[model samples]
Target: MRNLKTVYLFELSSLLKKKAYIVTTVIICVLILVVTTLPTLQSIMGGENTGEEGAFQEGTFGIYNESDEITLTHLGEKLPGVTLLPYESEEALKEAVLEEEVSSGYILKSSTDYVSVVNNVAMYSGGDYLMDSALRLVNEDLALQEGGHDVEAIRSIMSGITITQEEPIVLGKDVQNNYWVVYILIMLTFMMIMFYGNNVATYVAREKSDRTMEILITSSDSNSLIIGKVLASGTAGIIQALFMGVTLFAGYRLNYRNYDEEILDFLNMNVDPMLLLVYFIFAFTGYFLFLFVYASIGALMTKVEDVPSATTLVTMFVMAAYFIAMFSLGLSNESIILKIASYFPFTSFMVMFVRYAITSVSLFTVAISYGILILTAVFTAFASVKIYRFGTLNYGNTGSVVKLIKTALKDDNGR
Candidate 1:
C-alpha cells in the first residue's frame, strides 16, 4: 500500500488534464442547462398559454357548409381557442388546406355527415375529432331549438355540474413522479460504469504494453497501483456527475413556475432523501467493484488494442444488470426475481435502488443488500490485485481467464 496517495494523485491529475474529458464534461453540462431552461424560454417566446381555458386553442381549420341547417357561428363557439374560417366551396376549403393556410378542412354535407381532408396526416392530427365534437354539440342545439327549449340555458346548467375528485390518501409511492428520476439515475449509473470502467482497463493495458507496469511494480505494491488507479477514475467520474447534477437542479428551480401542474406533479421535487442515499451507496460500491474487475482484465492482455476484447465479459455482465433492472420497472412488487436481484451483488446496484424507489421495502432489507455489495467489492478488489500482479510478469500469454487465474494461484502457492 506504499505510495497509494502518490499514485492516486498522479492518475487523477492526468485525467483532469485530458482535453477530451474536459470538453465532454463541459458539453454535457451545457446541454443539461439548456434543456432544463427550455420551458422558461418557450414561455418568453409567446408560446400558447397552457392554462385550462387556453389549452384547446392550437390551430386554424377551414370549414365549408354544404348544408344550410347547421350554424357555423355556434360550431365555432363550441371549439374554443380554435379559429374557424368559412369557405364558399369545398374546392376553396381544400385549396386552403393544401396551401397550409389551415391545419385541415371540413366539408359539412348535412347535420350528421362531413368529409375531412388534409394534405398529410401527422401522428397527433386532431382536426377530425374537433369537427365531430363541434357538430355533435351543434346537432344537439338544433334539436333543442326545434323543441322550443332554451339551448344556452340548458348548456349552462350542464356545464355547471362539474365533478372533481379529491386527492386520494395513498400509502404507496407515486410511480408517475419517480419513474423518470429512477430511469435517469439508472442510466447514469450504467454510463458511468461503462465509460470509467473502460478507461481504467485501457490505462492498465497501456501501462502493461509500454513496460510501465514493470517499473511501477518495482517501486510499489500491486494493491496500491490497482486501487489508486480505480479510485482516480472513480473520482473523475464523480466530479463530472456532480457538475451535471447541480446544473440540472439549478436550471429546474429557475424554471419551476413555467411548467404546468401536470408536469410539476410528474417531476416533483419532493423526492425521499433516503432513496438518493441508497442510490449513491449502491452506485459507487458497484462502480468500484467493476473497475477493479476491469483493471484485472486489462492485466490479462499485453497490447492496448486487446483491451476491448479482454473487457467484453465484464461489459456483458454490466449490460445484463442494466437490462434486468429496466425490465423490472412497472412489474408487480411481489416479483421473486427482483427480490433475489436486490441481494445479488452484480445486479443489486441498479435493481435495489429501483425497488426502493417504487415499492415498499424495509430498512432491514436495504441493510442486507448493502452488506452483500460491500463484501463483494472488497473481495473483487483484492482478487484484482492478485491477478494484476501475476499478469504483469507473465506477459504475451493472453490465455483464457480461468487458465490465467489457475496459473496465478499455482505461482502464488509455489512462492
Candidate 2:
C-alpha cells in the first residue's frame, strides 16, 4: 500500500509537469465559457432580421358567402396575416384564384354542409396550411353548434386536456431539462476521459520507445507502475473536467442571472447534493477503469505513432456506445444493446450513468452495475500489470495480440 501510494503520487506529479496537460486544461475552460455565454449573447441580440425572404408577407384569399345573413367578422379577426376579399359568386372566387389575384379561396355553398377550398396553386406554399387550419376551426365550431353543444362546455373540455409532465427523480430531486443536460454531461465526461486516457497510454508507449521503462521497472513492480500511471493520467483528466465544469457553471450563472427564474423553472434544476456526490464517485471509478484499458494497449505498442492505430478498436467501441446512449434518451422501449452496454465493463461507465441520470433507474441496478464495473476494472488492471512487465522490456515492431497475451501469461507465471 505504501509503495503504491508513492508510485501514484510520483505519477501524478509527473503529469502536472507536462505542458500538454496545462494547454489542454486551458483550452477546455475557454470552450466551456464560450458555450455557456452564447444563449445570453443571443438574447441580447434579439429581433435581428432572420434573413429569410418573403416569410411574413400577407396571404390573399377570396371568399364567397352564399348566406348573406351570416357574419364572417369572427373569421376575419382570426386570420392575422391573411387578407380576405369579398366575391359576388363561387365562379368569381375560382376565377380570382386561377388569375393569381389571390393565392387561394374558399366557397361556402348554402345547399351543402361542407365548404370547398379552391386551390389552384401548389399546397406546399405557406398559405395552404394556414388556410386549412382556419377552415378546420370553422368546421369544428359549426359542427359543435349543430350538435347542440354549449360553447362554454366545449371550451372547457379543450382547455382541460392540457398536459403536465413531471421529471424523473434522481436521488431526492428531479432531473433537469428533460434529461438532456445529464446526457450532454455524461457525453462530455466520456470524451474527456477517452482523450486524456489515450494521453496516458501514449506516455507509456513513449517511455518504452525511449528505453526509460527499464529503469522505472527496476524500482517498481508491474502492478505499482500501472496503478501509478493510471492514477496520474486519470487525475489529469479529472482536473481538466473539473476546471471546465466550474468555468461553465460560473459563466451560466453570470450570464443567466436575469432569466434565472424562467430558466430554472423550465430546466427543473433541482438536483440533490447527494446525487452529485454519487455521480462524482461513479465518474471517477469509471474513468480509472477506462484508463487501465488505455494504458494496457499503450504498453503493447512499440512506438508513439502506433498508439492511435492500436487503440482504434477500443475508440470505435467507445464512440458507438456513446452514440447509442444518446439516441436511447426519451425512447419508451429501451434498447437491448444499450442495456447490455450499460453492464459491459468498457462501455458501462458512460451508458449506465446516463440511464441513471435520465430515468427512474433502480438503486439496486446502479449498485449491481458498479459492482460489475469495479470487478472488471480490477481484472483489467491485473492483466495490464502482467502485459506491462513483459512488453516494457521488448523493443521491436508492435507485438501481435496472441504474442502479447502469451508474454503477459508468462510474466504472470514468473511473478
Give per-residue CA lDDT, model 2, range 1-415, as digits (tens). Answer: 3378888888898887879778878887888887777767766778333433343335677878876433456556546766788889878888887887887677755322325555544535566556556656666666778899886688778979978889555443244444756676677766877787788889999988888888888887877888888887887777777788789779877877544455657555555554555466666777787788789878888888988878877787678767877777656445787688878867777777666655667788888888998898888778777777777766684456546666666765526
Each model's lDDT comes to 0.86, 0.72
Which residue pairs does candidate 1 place in steric collision? Answer: none
Task: Write out the backbone clash pairs for model 2.
Answer: none
lDDT of 1 by residue, 69-110 (tens): 877788888888888899998889989999999988888899
**Best candidate, lDDT-wise?**
1
Q: Against the hidden reference, what TM-scores do the models get? A: 0.89, 0.68
lDDT of 1 at 88: 96
Worst 10 residues of 2 by lDDT: 47-56
Candidate 2 Cα misplacement greater than 4 A, ranges: 1-7, 43-76, 79-178, 219-221, 260-262, 272-278, 333-335, 355-361, 397-399, 412-414
Report RMSD for candidate 2: 7.5
How does candidate 1 score on lDDT? 0.86
